[model samples]
Target: MTPFTSRIYLLRHGEIVEQDVLAGGTDLLLSDVGFSQLSQACKYLTDVELVQSSTLKRCSEFATQFSHNHQIPLLLTDDIREFNFGDWDGRKYDELWELTHSPSIGDFWQSPWLVTPPCGENMADFYQRVFLWWQRLLMNIVNNHTHKQLVITHAGVIKQLLGIICELPKESNQQNMFAVGYGKFVCVEIYIDNMGKAWPKIVF
Candidate 1:
């Protein structure tokens, strides 16, 4: 394969009012504060030719609005949805703590690969899914010579994407890994070397 360069802007969704609840996989809309957060984030974006987002309502809503206003191509898919909390979806943090009588969920947050919500997608599988989609996106960027692509996704997906690009090992703790605050964005530059190996660098 020929060498190529691609720049990706990874963005996390804005703040949600129900911060104390585990809303993964839930189809909640963005709150007014969240919209304000997104508005502030828009000031920092530049040269975004294409945008992709998780089809979940919170992400897709903003993505739709942005693409329409900026005249950028948009792609929404489930490939980047937040980690599935399954039965834990929509549950409150304090209530779960009282019921479990321990901070097992917090432990899961620290080392997701070792603990999973009941009936939820395990970290390993989630990693594979996100990595696979990333590979596809890389191919598209290299083939089409696309520059400045934006991805609006959940924090978990963003972290895993960074882990894959950084080539982190399986045992690495994802919860303690990369974190992006609400409505914030991180930029990375990916370059394919002479040997067709991909290298990534954080670019502000």
Candidate 2:
């Protein structure tokens, strides 16, 4: 068995406009505070190698800055877009709470995996896309044999990645695993064992 080391760093993009709402799939740019957060995050990753971000503007903006300063190419992929909120996009939690007929939203509040938003994607679908994306990313890391790979994406994307890497149950909680404030960052170190399995060893 051969031990291959591939370190992947997952980062949730900074805050966006209307964050208090359930703005899933809404392609809004980062807020002013988000810019500050992105700047702070760049400082922490000054030594990172490859950089990538979701196609969405919020993530892409920060990725551009990081790549520019570090002189590393920034790649964009659609695999990391935020969860599609469907009809719920651009609406706030309070608005959803006001809907009297739909108990489904309440169910989603309790267990996000159980309730599929009306006209939106189910948890399984979301997980599958994320998993596929991660597999591709892992393949790239293995091919390049990079020591550090930085990714800027959404909170939902980060949560799914954590679940996969940590081997957490699919039904695990989804509360703020990386609710990284605008410009703040969470560092996760993924290690590849001798069997070619990648797992998160350290997260900060």
Candidate 3:
């Protein structure tokens, strides 16, 4: 029997314009600070291989810089995009808070995992999409046994991945689950033994 090993570097994209604004799927570019963050992160990860990022501009732009610095190709995938806030898109927190008194808004906040936003996906559905992408990477490990892969994506996607790796409850503490800072990274090692059972070991 053969053993396989894979390492994943999960990176959150840098700060963006109007973070408090629910600009889901709005395609906003990164701010100046975001550029600096990307440069610093690239300097830190000088040896990472296989760079990939969400297709959105904010994520892809920073990924491009890292890819150039590391000399790795950048692949874009939609599965790692930010959560879609639907009717709440482009609105600030204060604006949304004003409307939170409505029953529909209340329900959306109370059970975001189960309740779909008007014309948008719920947290579960969004996680499913992210999992699909991760599944593809696992398949690559099974076939080619690649050692290291870097994924640059939105904060929400990173949080969902953490939830899966840690086996936390579906609606676990949001603060702890998604606290990845701008341009920061977390590393996970997936170890597969002779029987092909994979265990994820996280290294912060």
Candidate 4:
């Protein structure tokens, strides 16, 4: 029996106006350069059969346009939005780094699972939410027999999903290895055997 194959493109949205800020909750739209980046990154995405996106404007705007242009079905969801930064939601990174807080931005990056930002979503809870969302997503994909799907989301979400697929430690600090720049897409290929088991690999 032939194994079933699925390809999912985890695309990070393009740059925003305040490129240096943690504006996940601010919902800032992408800049012109950012739109260009997103478009160019998706130039070769003709094979995608479906498109999913974070409800945030930065990702959804482009996802809508891509879906319309490519004639693919589009879905907007909140489960895959960026990690809530709370008080740091709309602040610049440099500003946050200069804070006198105990667990500063640097501290969080070094040990995200252990450090919860000021009034922000707990890293553990965030991880669990994304993980659950991912599980449901894969099941849906397999059940629907989808060949290819595109997901437009944030850097943190993509990194978390990648870590899940690789079974990496939460302290792995995937930013160093992934370095998913704005408008970049991490290609993942999933293989399901006839025995009803699934294996996922990061193709890029």
Predicted model with the maximum lDDT: 4
Give Cα-based local distance difference scores for all models.
0.82, 0.76, 0.77, 0.87
TM-score of each: 0.89, 0.87, 0.87, 0.93
What are the per-residue Cα lDDT tens digits for candidate 1 across 42-67? 77687888999999988899899999
Model 3: residue 61 alpha-carbon error in angstroms: 1.3
lDDT, candidate 2, at 52: 84
Q: Candidate 3 — which pairs collide? A: none
The model with the greatest TM-score is: 4
Per-residue accuracy of model 3 over 62-155 as CA lDDT, tens digit each = 7887677668877888889888887877778777778844436557767776577777767777878977887787776667666787888877
lDDT of 4 by residue, 1-204 (tens): 356999999999999977788886678899999999999999977788899999999999999999998899999998899999888899988888899868788888788778888889988887888899889888886777788999999998998898899888866666447678899989999897776566889896
In candidate 2, what are the lDDT values of residues 1-204, reduced to their tens digit? 456665667777777876678767888898888877777766756567788898989889878877887789788988788898777777888888777766457777687777888888788888889999988877766566667878888888877777776777777664345354455455666666776666656465
For candidate 2, give the lDDT of residue 184.
49
Point out where model 2 deviates above 4 Å: 1-4, 172-179, 193-195
Q: Which portions of model 3 miss their true places by more than 4 Å?
A: 100-106, 171-176
lDDT at 22, model 3: 73
